[model samples]
Target: MNCEKIKGKVSIRTVLESFNLFPVKENGKTGFYFALDREEKVPSLSVDYINNKAFDFGTGKNYDIISIVQQINKTSVSDALKYLEKFNFQPQEIDQKEEVRSNAKYEIIQVKEVKHPALVQYLKYRNVCDQIHFVKEIHYQINGKKFFGIGFLNDSGGYEIRNKYTKICLGKKDVTLLKSGMDCQREVKIFEGFFDFLTYRNIQRGANEVSDYLVLNSTAMLFKAEELMKKYNIISLFLDNDSNGRLITDKLFNQYNAVRDCASIYTGFNDLNEWFCSSGRYCDY
Candidate 1:
C-alpha cells in the first residue's frame, strides 16, 4: 500500500487500512488519501506532522500512524475516521441504513434460566408486597441487553427497563404491580435504580405514609420531561446533586410543580443505593 509522507516516515496507508479505510492514490506516490463512509467520520482526533513525526492534537501525543489508528479502532471507530478527513482527503458517502451496531450490557448479565426464591424474598423484604407478586422472569435477546440495573412503571401504564443499549418495554401487568405497591400519590420519591427503590421501601415500612415512586434508570431519559410531568400531581425527584444528576433535576423542576432533592440530606452520597449502603440511616435494614 502507498502512504503519505506527512512526517517521520508515518505510513498513512497502514493507518487507514487497519481502520478498514482504503486510500485513493494519485500519480503513484506524492498524494495518497482515503475516502470515508458517512459512519466513518469523527472529528474528535486530529493529526498533524511536526518535526517529521505524526502528532495527534486531540491527545497531545506523537504517534506512529499504526498505533494511532489502532487506538482509534478500539475506542470508537466511527468517530476516529472523521478526524482523519480533516486533511484534504475525500470521504465516501455511506448510507446511514448500514450502521447497525451493538454495544455491551453494562449493568446486569443473564446467567441462566435459574429461578431463585431468594429474589422473591428480597422483593417482599423490601415492602413491595402488593396483591400481585412479580415473579422473576429472565430471558435473552440477540441485540444484547442492558443490565438496566433499574426500571420503573411509567405513567403510560407500562414498565420500562434499560437493556444493553436501549430501553426494553415491559407489560402493563408489571406496571400495575409496581403502582399498586407504591404509596406515593400526593408525595413522590425519586430513585436512580430499582435496588434503591427496594431500599427505600424497606426503610419507609414503619413510616406513616408511602410516597409515589419514580425510577430514572438513566438520568438521560429525564430529557423526556413531559413523560413524568403529565402523570403525577406532586412530583419529587430523588436525584444525586452531582453535575449530571443536578442538571437533569434542574431542567425537570422548571416545568413541573415541585421537585425534591433527597441528596441534600446527605450530599456526600451519589444516589439512594450509595446512601443506603453508607449513610448511617438505614443500618438496621
Candidate 2:
C-alpha cells in the first residue's frame, strides 16, 4: 500500500499484524530490544530495515514468513503478485533547488492551439468575450517538453502589444467559487494572483469559515476591484507588501470605499507565502 493507504488502516496492532511481527515490549513500550545480532552487534533486521517490498524483523522475534504468505490468499502467481505489489515500498530522498530565470530569453517556442469548443466553454464560464486574444506557450527541454506556459487574456496595454497595436497577454487566473456572494459573506479577501490564492487556501485549510476570494490578475487590474467592492460589504486586500503592491493597495483604498489593507501582516517579507514560511508561527497562516 502507499503511505496514505497504510496510514488510513494503521493502528498499533494492525501495523504489527501487517508485518507479521510484534514489538518486544517492556515497561509499557519503553524497552531495549532482545534479538540476535550481526558480527558487529547490530540488529540483523528490524522494522526500520525497510526495502522496496516489505520490512524485516530482528531475529529471536520468531515470525513465520509463511504466515504472512498465507494471510494474503491468492489463487495464482499473478494474483499473489498483484496482492504483494500493494505492500511494496521504497525509501527515497530528494532535494530541490530554486533556479532563477533572470532575463531569460525564450522564443515563441510553441503554441497550444485550443480547440474551439473547449475555448468557447471556458470563455463563457469566465464571462469573457470570444474575441479576447488567447494563446498558450509550450516550453521545450532537451528530453522533451518542460512546462506548458499559461494561456493569457490580451489587455492591449503591454510594450510588445502597444508596438503591435494588439492586446497584451494577461496571464490566466483561476476563479474561486465562493459559497455565497462577497457582500453577504462579511469578509472579502483579495489576492494578487491565483498561486497566492491557492497558497492561502493551503495555509487556511480547515479554517473555521471560508472567506471570499478575489484574484486580481495584475496590479494594473486593481481598478477592476472597484465594481466587486461595490457589491461586497467588507474587502480585505492581501497584496504583496512590496512597493508596487503597496502603491496598488493605496490607490484602491483611496478610490474605493469599504476596502482595508491586510498586507501589513507580512510587511517584513515581500510576499505572503514567504512571510508565512519565515514567521515561525504555529499556524500555517
Candidate 3:
C-alpha cells in the first residue's frame, strides 16, 4: 500500500504501541506519550489519535504516523513504510464526547513549598535540590484525577510541571524572566528549560556575580523573549546540544551581537543538567 493508504489504515496510537510505547496520561482522544528520541521523566509527546498525528512539546516537532515511525526507528520514509506494512488495521472513529473531552481543563488544586519526599528526591536526582526554593509543589487535577508535580512559574502565571513520571503545563505557556536586582544588570543567561537554569545556579553556587535569568520553557517560545532580550548587554545561552537548540542559538547570534553559545561547557552531553548528572563536575565560569 502507498503512504497515504497506510496512514489512513493505521492509527498513531497503534504505531506508538507497536514500539511498546504507551501514554502516561490521556484525556478523551488525546494522549501524552514519551518522546520517541529521548528518555524523559515526564511525557512530552502529545498524540492525537483522532488525527493520526503527534507533537513533541520538548522538540517542537510535529509528526504523522509515518514520521513517528521513522523517528522511533531512525529509518527513512521507505523503510518506515515497509515497517508499518505489518500493522494493517482499520482506524477507529472518535465519538463526540471524546472530542469535547480533549479540551477538558486542568484545575490547580494547590501550590505550596517543595517538601514532598518524592519531589525532593527528583530534585536531587537532577542535582538541583539546592535550587528548590525556585520551584513549588503543585497539586493539580485533570480529567478528574489528582496529580502533583514540581512547578516552575512563568511570567504568564502558568507552571511548568515536572515529576518522576509527568511533565506538563498547568496554564498559559510563556517565558520566565528573572531579574538579578542589580543596579545595572546587563548580563542575562538564557536556558531552554528551568532544569538547566537550576543546574546553572547549582554550578554557580557561592559565586558573587549577579545576572538575570530567562528560561524559554519551550524553544517555540523563543520569539516571546526577543523584546526582553534587547535589554541585556551579554546573552549567554545554555541550550541543549541538539538541532533545535543549535538552530535557536544561531538565530540569536545572527540577530544580536551579544549572544554567546555556552553549550561548549557541556561539550559532549545533551544539556547542562545531563553533563552535571553524568560527570558531577562544575563549570569553571
- Candidates in order have lDDT scores of 0.42, 0.41, 0.77
Candidate 1 positional error at 202, Å? 1.3
Give the C-alpha miss distance for residue 139 in model 2, angstroms. 8.9
If both were scored by TM-score, which would come out higher, candidate 2 or candidate 3?
A: 3
**How does candidate 2 fare on TM-score?**
0.38
* After superposition, candidate 2 runs with Cα above 4 Å error: 1-146, 149-185, 279-285
Better model by lDDT, 1 or 3? 3
lDDT of 3 at 50: 78
The top-ranked prediction according to lDDT is 3
Supply the global lDDT for candidate 3.
0.77
lDDT of 3 at 61: 98
Ranking by TM-score: 3, 1, 2
Task: Report the Cα RMSD per candidate.
Answer: 15.6, 23.4, 12.0
Full candidate order by lDDT, most accurate first: 3, 1, 2
Answer with 1 or 2, whichever has the higher TM-score.
Answer: 1
